[model samples]
Target: MKLLLDENLSWRMVNKLGVVFPEVVHVTSLNISQPASDISIWDFAKKNGYTIVSKDDDFEKIVLLRKAPPKLLFLKTYNLNTEKLVNLIIANNIKIKEFINSDENDIFEIFGE
Candidate 1:
């Protein structure tokens, strides 16, 4: 599944995982750095068929309410650097993708562990 990563995540994380997740993209790269509201981001994700991979719980709430192509994966913890975050994703890729594909209507949370 394609992922629309939030600006809260470092761009380098997307760069490093480019090979692993070929379609991973950041909001900055989408030229959405002009401070659009969260609703705008949700609209963008909905129109683009991209699931929201964000550090924001609002996205999770949006998914819980709206329920569709705008699926969410909310990263709960803070203070993680790019490398650690990359490792966490890599370690969990298969299971994560399986779950993502298994249910696009579900909202998921990933905590640093």
Candidate 2:
């Protein structure tokens, strides 16, 4: 599945994670305005078939309120360096795939182990 990384995440992650997630992209790479609104990002992802990867709770709130077209991968950990964060996501790749493929769920929460 395609993944649209949220602003809270580093744009550098696109290349790093691209090996496993070929369609991964950071929000900055898109044509949208810098500091895009959560709703705008959500709309973009919905239209483009991207599952949002974010550390922000705002996306979760949006999904709860509006339901999902663009799914969510919510990072519950904090204070992790880029490498650590990348590793966390990579290690959980299978779970991510499962979440993306599941028809019943829209949000997947990832906690640092």
Query: Which is the leading candidate under TM-score?
Result: 2
Q: Which tens-of-lDDT digit does each residue in 1-113 have in candidate 1?
A: 67888878787788777777888888877756456567887888889878777888877777778886677878776878888888878777786687678754477777894
Residues 1-113 of candidate 2 have per-residue lDDT tens digits of 79999999998888889988999999988999888999889999999999999999999999999998889999998878788889999999999999999988989999984
Q: Report the number of the highest-lDDT candidate.
A: 2
Query: Ten-residue segment with the worst summed lDDT in candidate 1?
Result: 28-37
Instruction: Give residue 11's lDDT in candidate 1 (0 to 100).
Output: 77
Please list the Cα RMSD from the true structure of every candidate, rounded to 1 decimal place. 1.8, 0.9
| Clashes by residue pair, model 2 | none
Model 1 scores what on Cα lDDT? Answer: 0.77
What is the lDDT of every predicted structure here? 0.77, 0.93
Query: Candidate 1: TM-score?
Result: 0.87
Model 2 gets an lDDT of: 0.93
